[model samples]
Target: MESKKKIMSEKLPITEVNPINSRYYDYAHFTYPWHFHSQYEIIWVKESTGLCFAGDCIERFGPGTLIL
Candidate 1:
């Protein structure tokens, strides 16, 4: 049998409410590099318009966009 290791992010944020937490980020520009975490993330683009780079896919997202 073989096992695979998922890519971990060095920029993993420190959640005050570990196990579950949420917050809004307003940035003048996309500041995060392509990264992944051990947990799932639900992101809602409230403002600004730009492209999203996920694993093996590229997408355009804007206000009211929801990502899971």
Candidate 2:
């Protein structure tokens, strides 16, 4: 499947304002759309509970959860 290039926000918390575009999210659920990027992306679930879908794999994620 061909992935899409998402253009994240540039205003601080919306997206990484700095050069190395890595940002933090503090919310209740995983609501971001299922998309992909050329740059490596990492997700660290600090709180709450939800499911993560990657390709054909589906896993439950919660506090202390990290995905790359």
Best by lDDT: 1
Supply candidate 2's per-residue lDDT for 27: 56
> Per-residue lDDT of 1-68 in model 2, one digit per residue for the tens?
99886744333333355446665676566666556554555778788887787656799988899887
For residues 1-68, what per-residue lDDT tens digits would candidate 1 score against the true structure? 89875555754565767667667777888776556866677888888888887767789999899877
TM-score for all predictions?
A: 0.65, 0.60
Q: Report every candidate's CA lDDT.
A: 0.75, 0.67
Candidate 2 clashing pairs, residues 3+ apart or interchain = none
